[model samples]
Target: MADITAAMVKDLREKSGAGMMDCKKALNETAGDMDAAMDWLRTKGLAAAAKKSSRTAAEGLVGVAVSGTKGAAVEVNSETDFVAKNDQFQQFVRDVTQVALDGAGDVDAIKAATLPNGKTAEDTLTTNVATIGENQSIRRVKRLEVSQGAVVAYVHNQQSAGLGKIGVLVALESAASNDALQALGKQLAMHIAAAFPMALNEEDLDADLIERERAIAAEKAGESGKPADIVAKMVDGAIAKYRKEHALVSQLFVMDGKTKISDVVAKAGKDAGAEIKLVDYVRFQLGEGIEKEASDFAAEVAAASGVPQQPAPVN
Candidate 1:
């Protein structure tokens, strides 16, 4: 067998438009023969599939899967909402999310994992794109595992089991019964999904963001006609308030609208006969911060109906 080089992989990818893993596999199977590699990819329908890789896929589903004390979530995106309902795409998201469960929150590891059909994650994405007639992607994935506690998962806006528009995982570290811990974990995960808090505590919050807020607060304090001591106190107060509002455990639980999540966890811990800690969490909301062009429906309607009489005014 001929030794396949990196250049061969690159060339195969360029010609077939297939993913790196798929290209390499094809090249290796063809004994580093470029023409044979191209033919192999084409026969598998992977070449045409790769051509759709460049399309913007900002809409799709978030999927979650849990196994024992670990849980994982993944975001699989498509170019349009119509494809999100495709059974195959949904199944891919769900299966990939399960694969992510074994990855220990490593996105790269999850992407490199083999799919059930003996294809890499990237190859699955390419195949999905070709069959669905739209570009698709495994946008992100995260796994949460606990040594002595349970990792609970939640999927919001679910179209099917373990697949949805929002996915969340909450890790609760405790020596309590899994049943009790999981109940609390589910509620906490829901709280996190709804609130989108920055961190679990003030110390964990983004330092740069905190510093920026403090600067703004100090500037405001300087105009208050107070002494330096008073200004310092004012800045401290502002920062404390910011921390309470932004931190996960400090923030009020959205479901209840009054109690802090930390307080709830403390109470649950007592009932469970162990000290419970919110060690970590992961939340994946589909297309978060992905800007899509907004259209004015009324304007489009008028233009289509030939009723657009308004002319641009000279500035």
Candidate 2:
């Protein structure tokens, strides 16, 4: 076995168009022989897979899997929706999501977890990218579980049975019957998909987000020409409202639009003759935060045709 240096691996990745891990493995497999490494990558088809790795992949599916008291959600992105519909790509999302439900709680863990095909998730992903002829990536994974009750999974705008545009999991802890838990969990999951709560509770909201809201509120209050005490009160009120509107428990239930989620859970528990708690939740909207690049199609066509620029008439 040879000691594979970073520079050597970088060289192999450049020449072979393979991922960093694959390049390093190739170098190690061939005792640092660059040509042998290239052959190794080519044999596995890893070299061709990553040639398009630089392309932006913002379209794909969010897959969900649930078992007993646990559930998992995963987002696998592809450069185009056409590729997303590929059978292989959908299977990858399904397999990786099951891995997440089995305890791979994070992106790295899911990638490292082995698939039924005897390939690690990363290897499977690379192989898919090669066969699919598009850049693809496992964007994220989120798992939720409860101690005593149920973890329910839901998908909206589904492309397949459990893969879709929006994936949600709702964890409910209770001694209630499975039927009751399922019903409550489904409604809550549906609410989560539509409402898009930021956190399970107000205190769970991101500190930076809260601070940014506070700053915005303070600036608005400052423009009010009110007394310092009144301005401070206004800022506080704004922050409080923001937190309530964004936190899951404090948010008004989307079902009827009047009941807070906390109250909804309480009523459901009362009807079930037990104490039911909303334990945790995850909502993954595919490509939610990705900034997609916009291309000028007409400009690209003109450039391809080698045509001169034309000015538009004044409106």
Candidate 3:
């Protein structure tokens, strides 16, 4: 069995929001497996379903750029947040995003593309890491384009012009006026930032994700002690609700909290004197889905002071 360290227990506590002793016990039961420990806590009703184990340890900027009907967004992750604030790091992100505009959102292509400084983007990133004293990478790039109409960009918690923690792009296909399209796009982009929709429509959602949610709902419904038919109905209802809540068009608009996003887009199009179709959208939240290494502060201090580290006391 894997030894359960105090840091592992602490990480489980943070992920499950359970007591320290409970977290330690759960980790032991799961053989020091973090994912299994979280599941054990949830099964025992000691943790909330919304609790997530993913850590946002990587820090950097999400840079966005819009030119005419095309827009691009790039995420550059650094080992530390302090580097995110560095002018050189920020400039690298900005330039990489601009490179992505022509790279068609391909990370490899963007890396090979030329920068204004006459060096390959990948070479510049390596140079930045050496000078900035931290590891960094161009994590992701996404571009949106429309044959007609405008692609609007928005940055939430803006760190600078076109750079922020959350970057969003909304693509509208329409013959509408640019000003009207941009206004509607900005509103939709802001909604995407807040709502965190999984997909543009129900059909667009991941099949695997939907199946997993269905399995969980079915298990929960089965525990209700209802008839098999009733349990089936309950599971279906839960899945339908999940789809409505997660799909962008079916989700309620954040602005009004009552109108569906599909209806909001229809009304905006009518007001703009043209028909607008929300063709696509992208929302990039930094460090999402990345599991960072848990920091061992006690060990760090012990090493710094040249003293042996002590194990945490178990209650």
Candidate 4:
């Protein structure tokens, strides 16, 4: 067996983006063969899934596709909105969205899945980057399915027919007629796109996020100079309100702005004569969590406002 050296371990770590120990183990598993070790790391998902040219955060399109009880949403990001509006880029997003709907399930899986052009999705993206002279990557993908109901899709700030800044998929499970389910799902999807609930339910909310909110609430309540017990009660109340306001079912429907989403679904169920459950949803807002480079931001500002490079948008 070939001996693994620190230089080999460091090199593998840089190449695979895996932990030092993992890289060393991969090298050992492949008998210190770098190419084989890289493949080993990828097979274990320790390497980057996409062959990205750069890590700079940039603009892109969110694409949504639907078929009966299943729907898929994907975000394909590029170096600029100009590239996002490219015909080739849009077609690539559409193709990847369809691949996700066909059960690609996640970004890694979709990147490995074959496109109609007989190339893997990642290869197609690499080719697009080279041909279009802009770096791009398949940022993310989400798929939703319902057992006996409909999954509805909505695109906000559309760049094309199915490509947009925000893509939402709502899954409604029921035995009601498909027509009724479709109508309800569309309305709910619109509401989801607008309200931006953090989770499907109070129980589904992230614990860390909840704790962060609680900390902020406590600090604000402490400023009221109340007794310890009163302050504790106030914090609890604040947390309860936060949970309600940030959960999909508990949020007031955007249309009426008074009735809770849970109530809206129940009323719709009554109208359709079946029990309906809002099961799950996926919302992809373009470039939401990406870390943007200042240079990229300046260029985006220039492109968007038709002015020379300026500071990024305040919001």
Instruction: Pick the TM-score winner.
Output: 3
Query: Which pairs in model 2 have colliding backbones?
Result: none
Off by over 4 Å in 1: 1-57, 222-228, 295-315
The residue-by-residue lDDT of candidate 2 on 146-230, one tens digit each, is 8899999889889998999889999999999999999999999999988888899999989987876676567667877899999
Find the candidate with the highest lDDT and give its number: 3
Candidate 1 pairs with clashing backbones? 105-143
lDDT for each residue of candidate 1 in 1-315, tens digit (9 for 90 to 100): 889876678767865788999999998899887766765675565775222222233789999988878988888888789988998888888778878776736667766889898998778888888878998887777778889788888887788988887788899889988998889988998888778777888799889878766766776678787999999999999889989988998999888799999999999999989989989998788887564554557778888999984754757
Candidate closer to the true structure by TM-score (higher is better), 3 or 4: 3
In model 4, state the lDDT of residue 251: 99
lDDT of each: 0.80, 0.86, 0.88, 0.86
* Residue 104 local lDDT, model 1: 37
**Cα lDDT of model 3 by residue, 185-294, tens digit:** 99999999998898999999899878877777777788889999999999999889989998999999999899999999999899988899999998988887777776
Ranking of all predicted structures according to TM-score, beginning with the best and ending with the worst: 3, 2, 4, 1
- What lDDT would candidate 4 get against the real structure? 0.86
For each candidate, what TM-score against the reference?
0.72, 0.78, 0.91, 0.76
> In every candidate, how many clashes are there?
1, 0, 0, 0
